[model samples]
Target: MKILHVVDMISQQRGGGSAKVPYQLGEAQARLGHKVTIYASDFHAEDQLPPKGVELKKFHCALNLLGGVRITPSMVFADFSQFDIVHLHNYRTLVNIIAANKGRPYIVQALGSCLPINGLTIPLHNFIWRNLILKRASALIAIAEMEIGQYVAEGADSKRISLIPAGIKCNEFNRRPARVKDGKKRVLFLGRFHEDKSPVLLAKAIKILNRNDVILLMAGYDDGCEKTMRRQIKELGIEDKVDYIGARYGKDKADTYAMADIYIMPSRREVFGLTLLEALACGTPVIATDRCGVASLLPPECGLVVPFDEYALAKAINEALDKDIASSYREYRIKWAKQYDWSKIAPKIIEVYRKVLGT
Candidate 1:
């Protein structure tokens, strides 16, 4: 089957969860003998193309002068009839809206943009999605059931909507037996340093816990929010307890996970966090928020799930540290993460492609 995956950008570093999902799925599908072509923006030279087996098409996501307002190209005005399935990623720009109206079998994978944060854009995007795309779509894939509910509320056909959780490459996050070290309980927060990530909350939780032996490793680019987080740490008087290692990915990410005793994600909202899976696959127990879709993967035996409150998070952290259940929980984490491996999940996507194209 010929599949066209449309997204705004394809760089792994753009720090958008949506970009990772489609790229992972597209690559896996291509590996499985499907013809996959990705349409992404050339924002960074490093993000110009995808890996082998998938053809990457470049497009400019720059601004056009329409009375000095920055706007994306209209998708409703593009030609999109070449593929059997048009899977739109984070291409929620004007170009996608134009392309959606094109006569093709459409499927939208909502990463996390459809939440209330978009305000009036939700209604407007929905109007175009429902009346223009969803009404004519072959299917719509929602990463979480919560997202599926949102799509249904916007009048999307329930039959056409599938709650398909994003799959991680298990080998990329597999347990390393030799790297475990016994030391102070380390709480790691490895993600974008954004307001939604709520890095300050994790810092505040560490401050409240007041565990001198517990260290906080905040790894990722601050993107200018580091100063605010530093102020919070200073106000809480835990500056000495936190270490900021800016922006580590790939092997550095794996090594950090290898050393950590616990993985913490205090995100206020997460559709499905890939890092959560990465942590679990590394045999590291997690203490994630109830709002995170990744928390669904956490059984009581594996880790703790708490509300976004600092006290609640701190309490969970203490409980995890005090129990010394690392070995047992690590075993459970590895077993649990293996079930969601892309090696297993990719087949379902291939089946979806075949079903959509009737090949």
Candidate 2:
């Protein structure tokens, strides 16, 4: 099968998990003896490259309308009819609209963007995309079962939706040494320092806990919220207790996870929590909000889930710090993470592809 994945950008710094899913899936499909190509805009060329066995084709972009939407005029000149299947990642982009108009049997990966939220242009955007574009796709892939209703409500046929969780490179993370809490326990929060990720809530949680022995390490690229977070940190007087380490990847990211005692994800909403899975694979206990899609897949022995409240998060952090479950649960966490390995997940995606192609 010849498969082409269409996304906004291919760089890890800009695309985050959207870029990763296609790279991993393409690699997995290539390993299965299928031809896979990833078509994306070359917005950030300095970031990490895709894995082996997956072909990457990048084009130049003309403009970026919204912060999230990419406008690549070059896509209009490209020929997409040769591929057996085209997979579109993320919606509300000119790239996706172009791909959808190519008259090929395509699939749309929602990436948690299907849900209706209070926004000025989002409702109108979704209505047009859902009715005119997405509803006609071969299939709509939902990363979590919780997202199926959102698609259905937006006029997608229920039978046309396939629930496939995003996968990770488990071996890279599982090979790391188990997290050790030798001196002051380190609590790590990794992801964009944006309002949606609830970074301010994390700072408030640290302030509420008021612990002298624990350190909070916040690592990620700033998505226009660093100033507000810093202001909150200073206002709460937890400046000394928190450390800001800008965006980590590769070995640095693995090392950061290995050094942490607990990984905290206080997101108000998440379609899928890739970092949480990475923490589990590294045998680092986690404290995540229940709103995260991956929280449902987490084993009880691996992590704790609480509501997105400062006090609730602080209490969960206190309990995780005081409990000595790391050594006992290390193997369990590693074992649970293996279920999400790309080697296992790829087959499920392949099955969906086969269904779409009727092969």
Candidate 3:
């Protein structure tokens, strides 16, 4: 099968999970003997190229609007009919509209953008996108079951939607062995430093813990919230307790997950928290919000799932630290994450593709 993947950008440092998912899925598909080509605006240099097997066609973006939507002529002019299926990564983009107009059978992986969390205009945008564009697709890939209702509400046919969780390279994270109590516990918050990510809440939670022995590693790209986060940290006087390591990837990313005793994701409105999966895959327990789609996948013994509140988060963190479950649960966490491996997940996605293509 010849598959074409269209996304705005494909950079490890900038694109985050949205870029990584399609690239990884494309690689997985290629390993299954499918010819996959990813089309994106090449914002990164040659040093930051995508993985092998999946072909990448880079184009320059003429303009970027509304923070994420890119206007690329290359995408508009691309021959969509050349591929058996065109898979779109995100919606509300000019590229997606162009693809919709191209008369090819395409599939849309909403990537949490379909949820009407942004504002009134976004809901309207999504409603129109779903009714006019997405409804015509061969299928709509819902990363979480929670998102299926949102798609249905937006006028998508229920039967046209398929639930497929985003997958991770489980082996990439080097799982840690049972650790001896070193008197110091490390709490990690690894993702975009944004308001929606609720980094401020995590900082506040760390302050409430008031523990001298615990260190919080706040690492990720700044999404216009660094100043606010720094201000909050200073106001709360937890500067010494937190270290701001900007954007970690590859071995460094894996090592950070392995070293951490507990990983915290306090996102207020997350569609799916991929980092939570990575943390568990590395044998590190997680404290994620109930709002995140990843929370649904977690078992009670794996980690704590709390509401989106600073006090609740702080309490969960404190309780997680007090329990000596890390060593005992290390094997369980790794075993649980194995089911979400791309090797296992890709076959499910291939099944969806085959059904869509009627092959």
- Point to the candidate with the largest lDDT: 2
Would you list the rank order by TM-score, best first?
A: 2, 3, 1
Instruction: Estimate the TM-score of every prediction.
Output: 0.90, 0.95, 0.94
What's the CA RMSD for each of the models? 3.1, 1.8, 2.1
| lDDT string, candidate 3, 181-234, tens digits | 678888889999888899999998998889998999988988889898899899
Worst 10 residues of 1 by lDDT: 67-76
Indicate the residue-level lDDT of 353 in model 2. Answer: 80
Off by over 4 Å in 3: 44-47, 117-128, 177-182
lDDT of 1 by residue, 226-268 (tens): 7888887898898889888877767778878878878898999
CA lDDT, every model vs. true structure: 0.75, 0.85, 0.84
Predictions ranked by lDDT, top down? 2, 3, 1
Ten-residue segment with the worst summed lDDT in candidate 2?
A: 174-183
Give the per-residue lDDT of model 2 (tens digit) for 167-209: 9888878645545546687889998988889999999999999
Q: What's the lDDT for residue 48 in model 3?
A: 55
- Which candidate wins on TM-score? 2
| TM-score between candidate 3 and the true structure | 0.94
